[model samples]
Target: MLRMNINNLIKIFFLLVILSIEIGQSLIPLDRYSTSSILIDKKLFFFGGETVHNLKPSTTLDQILYLDVSKPFNTVNPPFEELPNTIPFGSSYAIAFPSSQKNVIYLFGGITVNVNTDLDDFKSILHSYNLETNQWTIPTTSGIAPGRRREISGVINNNTGKFYAFGGLSDQFTGTPNNTIALNDMNIFDINTLAWSKGSTINAPLPRADYTATLLSNGIIVFIGGRETNAFRDVDINQLALYDTKVDKWSLMTARGVTMENRFLHSAVLTPDERIIIFGGRKVPNDDPVLNQLAVLNTKMTPYEWSIPQVPAIDNMPLTTSAHSATLVGNYMFINFGQITPITNPQIQLPFFYILDIRNFTWIIQFEPEKSTIDTTSVNKSPSNSTSNSPDLPVEKSDNGKQIGIILGTVGLSIGIGIVVGFLGYKYYKKQKYKHAIPTAGSPTI
Candidate 1:
């Protein structure tokens, strides 16, 4: 009977372990990378991008995906809702920026792959989407649109209702790095006039591609690291270029805090507090993207400064990557899919995403597929090290405290129960030995 009790307890303990795993997995969402995203109201809308199965490329998705992130969400419970109307063609590396009109966003210039040759075709037309009507439309512009390209970045001035487009690549639609020329031209589109006019390129940054351009509160555009040429040595490292719209002037900014090296294809988003947060990009095409640190540029200060925040080595943190998109929605920054590892297969799929609580500097993986080997999210409140000049920022608040507590609690309880069961089993074994050794019916001992 005692042995049977021990077996039963062991089974119960196993059952508990399984339950804990299931509960933890249910909270992780599936991953999708290389998509364009925009936040309207509290909903995040994802447009055409690539999805992968193993290392093989799946079909490029054209359907619009929407997720209501106003509350804590289980990514797979209902999955992301897809709109019935699909974009004319599936695309990737497109620009999706919000317009002055609420619930409206402009989608411009992306590349569609030629399925047969696996080459990319740059798009020249401009498209717009309305969140309320669930509609997509091709808008008319007076002047000619910019040349066909992808991996281009843009920003909109909400106060002025004008849109600005900066540097991007021109040709090489074959997906080959050779024969590509980066542009340094700037274009302006007046939303009210619906006319496109070329801005002065007299003092613009060097011709570059795969760089991040962020519009600050003071109307200055901050252009961070990117490659001026395909050659790794030609890539701009630890450099910053600032463009002032008011004066139509471009000048190099000498940032004094964290010293970051050259990175391209990284994503940057303006925080609510007038700070620009830059995350994951590649040092060079051949090298893996930086995976461990995030650079914060405070635009509110004169002679802008940067602070490098260290990400804790936790299971749930998303892989540091380049070519990803980071969208700011309230206090949360939603990081969408991009290349996670060094491009083993240029067609590789990275389906995971992460969320940074900017207020507290905590990181969490918003979604990871079941087939994924990524770990659960973890938060480190303190910076690994700080420079004497870095600002004393508020500690970011962590929302996963309860979840972390529960996971730790469950594991602890299971361990404790296992130890108690083992002790009882040991005692039972000793009692049985004593009984067996005792003489019964005057039997002689051997």
Candidate 2:
């Protein structure tokens, strides 16, 4: 009987250990900034960013991390898998895009930090990683590559197999603020021929960095929200810069509707119906994360209007974040690791990843395949009908919060029960052993 009780206690202890591991896995382990991410097939790959939180000349990460979007995942616990092979060099603020060919991801132009030293080196070469074989290679290329720069904005044209890179900071802290050069030139990379060529820079926007370059269905790349000249100044937020890939020309237009302040280091996703959803970034002058974290730009509308979609307040809704990666998978946009506060601010908090369902503008904590569908009625209408304030949308409750709560409760209960059982079993065993022990020769019998 005693042996059986001991075995049962051991079993309970092991169960407790396993449960603790499961709980640990639910917490996010990644802390990164300025990372570039791309969605290829069903997997989303993240590469090259600073990992450490408060270090100057921040630590650059070389490991490639990926999450399978096809599988069910949640903000509480993202199933991010790391590839065994690392990139050729550690980098941050690089541009990553998929090649027209299968299983190929291209990385271009990021700065590398030597953790042991103060030297920060700028990378100018193009590197390719093969997903199938898990290999990284620097392919030989022809034509002049863009001058070494980081915080560059780039988008790949699937139709022509070309990548358009524009506007990046050439140097950082080389001397005074004026020494840091912001570039306005456009560089084109051909995936098929492994060559680089200069794109037309006539009427290009002024030198900028940390901006977003989104490719439209019509082959026009839209440039938005970045710092100009140096990191201190912001480009005019009113001017909508458009680059026509077909004509190799650049033009500026204006957006109407709700006015938006200057922002940089934000993430933008082009929805299926041609709407650009802009999320979290630092604003100008003070470099604080924008309080209004979500905005929508309807590209299909004439003269392009920006609207603030009213997001229902939820317990697990993401906090303000910048330098994050937002990947549009299906109708849901998955936002990954980013700092909640500005790097300069001492109170830095990194929020867990979150998802936004674009169909009806719902914030989802978990990925539910059944719920992922296009609500045609919601997509056709303007996101915000009123200009006075953000348009209020209907609040739809999600079961994900309850599900997470139940899971945590169950785990907690199991752990508590295991502890009690183990403790009781231990005490009972001690009492039994004492009762059964042979009395010492000198001891008096009761």
Candidate 3:
């Protein structure tokens, strides 16, 4: 009787375990989509740029926006709160990094409205906003200021508490109707020390501006193809490369896997799996064509490789435009902004967030965002990751926290239930055999 009770308990436990796993997977939205440079804290950050409306001959912008990146679709409020007007004029060349000791957001450089002129000109100063204080502090740099540049690629080196900026035009902005390629420089800024330094190319380096740079987990900074200055076209060079900060050397191993085409103002998301998820850059073919395609570059390989990532549909693809931004949550990617202009004037609207859930290999187009801003939509919630995907088999990260929890719970419950079920079965079989062997009442005991 005791054994039978144990067996029943075990069966119940197993069923419970399976149920738990299923529940976790079912409830959690495990995927994210993006068309922006991705950064994080407890929250996600992105600054919007001038779309068609503001892309006048010499337009400067004033909008800085961000999103939570972790909202569920059914959520009615949609949780995107526009932050208080912190910066006066909108600018795109802004880079955000956490301060040395405090949790304050240090937003430095790019372009902004000059208090006196209101012209969208190069901003040399830095602004530090305390998320806790809701105040802004402009800190001065001791060394030479990084010359003004736009669409420069930058990433905060977590190891050194410094920001390394690469590939941007010089402070020289020619007011030409078109054709400006003079601004090209790579530099590094020490966030802690507040110093500026320039980078010299080791080998044949691409002096390309408006390029994409993502910091890999291994501390290596991988750079992908970008646009050359006011040339209005992506560079002829489409190869990828990585700069090892420790060694201060560049590597040629960035040209492997699927070769990416030349694109500018494209967005790359470092998936939890360590693969760079890239999307929506205007492609400059021999014959220029606007692209609305998606791709992924695997930076884990020694020769960093790239290939087009698969999204669900062709009908509802992201509209072809640059100056847009994207963020990732779980396996899904959230893309927004980069105003659509038949001509460069500017009509602003929140493009409904497009989410790519990776678990079921599905893409969900959610249109019912309830907020004017996107502070709550584009979040990256991937777990600990490693690059083990071979050329053939691609490894995916935990679809989302909820999915992972469900899987673990299911496994636990299965074992728990299995123990009880096995025990009961054994006990019942033992009782049957014992009865068969009993001889005292006319059967011989074996």
Candidate 4:
């Protein structure tokens, strides 16, 4: 009987262990947008962002979440690990880029939200995180820093060891009647010396933010469409602002291609062949038609040309994604969390990160393309006719919610079984003790 009881307890313990593993595997990070992420040595580290929960106010997240891209992982069950925070700091619209030196990532300006007051406080401080040490530090530096700002477009020239920060939504005029100012001034940061310096504002484009700044191989930075100083206007899509870093001069070039609508809050990634692929973004008005097509800009040509690629329609493809981080890893571009719909509707959580194989422009859910079918085709400049209506509700029900329900149910069942087994074991031990007990000099015996 004793051996049988021990066996039963052991079996139950193993069952609980297996259930716990399942719960852990199903767990994923919260839904977030405007998050900054950096890809270092095949590991993608996600920084501060605003998290959205059903029926609750959005919350700024301080936690650091990361995914190992070197290994093959399922999209539904992404193996994301959380790095412990040494100091708590959270913000949205921040930019994170890896240093030329290995194992270091630098986070620049962003806006911190005061949930209690529902106000935004812009930040201009610099924070550095060491992947090797797993430590975060605010490094002191000499020279003047840029004004408090968010949604700033920045890019690092690894050869020069400098980070170039351009136009952003500044809070310099916060107390003044203007209250909002778009900055076109350039700020330079020396990664090696930990110092800041202002760059030239000569012939800069109209003050803008929520744009993309891509660094070319020939020491030139290309600025794309963005929200201009006038909050309601977007920078013209036909003009490409080129900043020649070698001489610190700015010039505007006209791009030849199909007439494209103005866009902001979009993501752009440079291809090996000098093509800038522009992904999802929104127009000035949030309710306007969504920019669901991918725009490719060929920069190597004497005159820059734009083309809207025809991508095969795939189910569950994000029709609208803005304020998202897109990082290119080899042939695949990994798009992180972002708002899929207008801000007026409830934010829906995405179960998986979207992956695009730039080689053939195929949308994939898994990291490894071999596990899924790949329909390859040559580049076609044909326009996309696919149009998506602004979804009144979430596009798809989140699998995370169902997973949470399963975990909760399993926990409840586990606790109930534990309690019953514990009670039976106790009763059995008490009966055995009584049956084995010897009567001494008791006055009354039952």
TM-score per model over all chains? 0.68, 0.74, 0.63, 0.75
Per-residue lDDT for 1-446 in model 2, tens only?
Answer: 53455456567767766664444334333367778888886678888677553233436766677876766766766766667687656777888988766998888887766544636553545778899998887778999877778888799888888999997987655666637678888999998887899988788888899888899999989888899876679876667899999999888989898888789888899998899999988877776777678899889987889899988888877777888888888888888877775555544334348899998888998786443532333335647655567687665656786566566755665677777666556545543442333232221100
Each prediction's RMSD over C-alphas, in Å, is 19.9, 18.2, 22.3, 19.5
Q: What order do you get sorting by lDDT, best first?
A: 2, 4, 1, 3
Winning model by lDDT:
2
Sorted on TM-score, best first, the list reads 4, 2, 1, 3
User: Compared with the true structure, what per-residue lDDT tens digits does model 3 show for residues 76-134?
Assistant: 22334334563555555556667775657776656565434557553554677776666
- lDDT for each candidate structure: 0.66, 0.75, 0.55, 0.73
- Model 1, stretches more than 4 Å misplaced? 1-31, 52-59, 74-79, 100-102, 113-123, 172-178, 230-234, 345-350, 365-446
User: Candidate 1 or 2, higher TM-score?
Assistant: 2
Model 1 agreement with the true structure over 257-350: per-residue lDDT tens digits: 7667677778888887889898887666475657444788887777778787766767666666666678876666777666665655343343
Candidate 4 lDDT over 350-444, as tens digits, reads 52388888999888777873422232342247887686676676546687875676667566656866865565555455434433332332111
lDDT of 3 at 101: 52
